[model samples]
Target: MSIPLVIFLFAWFVFLVIFTFLALVSVVQMLRFGVAGPGTYLSTVTFLAVTGLVLGGVGLYLAGVDWNATLDIALTPLL
Candidate 1:
């Protein structure tokens, strides 16, 4: 089977969109309902920091990839 390498990039973009929506919802829920304390603020800050670091790292890694290509896979059947 063969598929365009760009398919993975499109999939990643979809995942990123969903992740961003969920992250926004989580922060809103946390702030709207959680007790007012340093713990709540700290947790939100930590979550945002980790999310930024991970996304930044992935961006750097993806910058070098050549998206104009295709991937081919071979499958063998055993019966």
Candidate 2:
């Protein structure tokens, strides 16, 4: 692979790993502490955690080779 592709893949992988880990941690924390904690703030935390996970997944799908057939082919020669 070309250097830019390699770099993009590496950066995306790292970003996904770190973001997923953080989202998971937040979800766990929300589950654990939410019930005993404040009502309004707990809901906000849950919302943020779920949103983070969903956005992270979308980013992964976009960055990974999942959509390669259409876009990848066009970009392959450039790479």
Candidate 3:
């Protein structure tokens, strides 16, 4: 609800959308071009995109729950 939290959530949402979009694009390109085209590069991109999307989704869900508490819990271990 605070300005910084809202901004953080917005950025996180944007990243999730972008990651999901990239993943879909990567899969489509891989299928259309096969292994001979972009080859392993596409595969790598697809993997990273999938990982990012999953993690981002979890982050967004946590943010929706209680952003402050979630952030505190998440950062606690790091500190």
In order of listing, the candidates' clash counts read 0, 0, 0
Indicate whether candidate 1 or candidate 2 has the larger TM-score: 1
Per-model TM against the reference:
0.85, 0.45, 0.46
- Cα lDDT tens digits for candidate 3, 1-79: 2244555778977987997798779767767667665666767677878797878888687756754533433344553
**Distance (Å) between predicted and true CA of 34, model 2?**
0.9
Can you give the lDDT of residue 36 in candidate 1?
100
lDDT string, candidate 1, 1-79, tens digits: 8787889999999999999999999999999999999999999999999999999999998898888877776553556
Candidate 2, residue 27: CA error in Å?
0.6
> Best TM-score goes to which candidate?
1
Candidate 2, number of clashes: 0
Per-model lDDT: 0.93, 0.67, 0.69
Candidate 2 lDDT by residue in tens digits, 1-79: 2243455666877987898788778767777666665784768677887777887887787766633333344446752
Higher-ranked by lDDT: 1 or 3: 1
Best by the lDDT measure: 1
lDDT, residue 9, candidate 1: 95
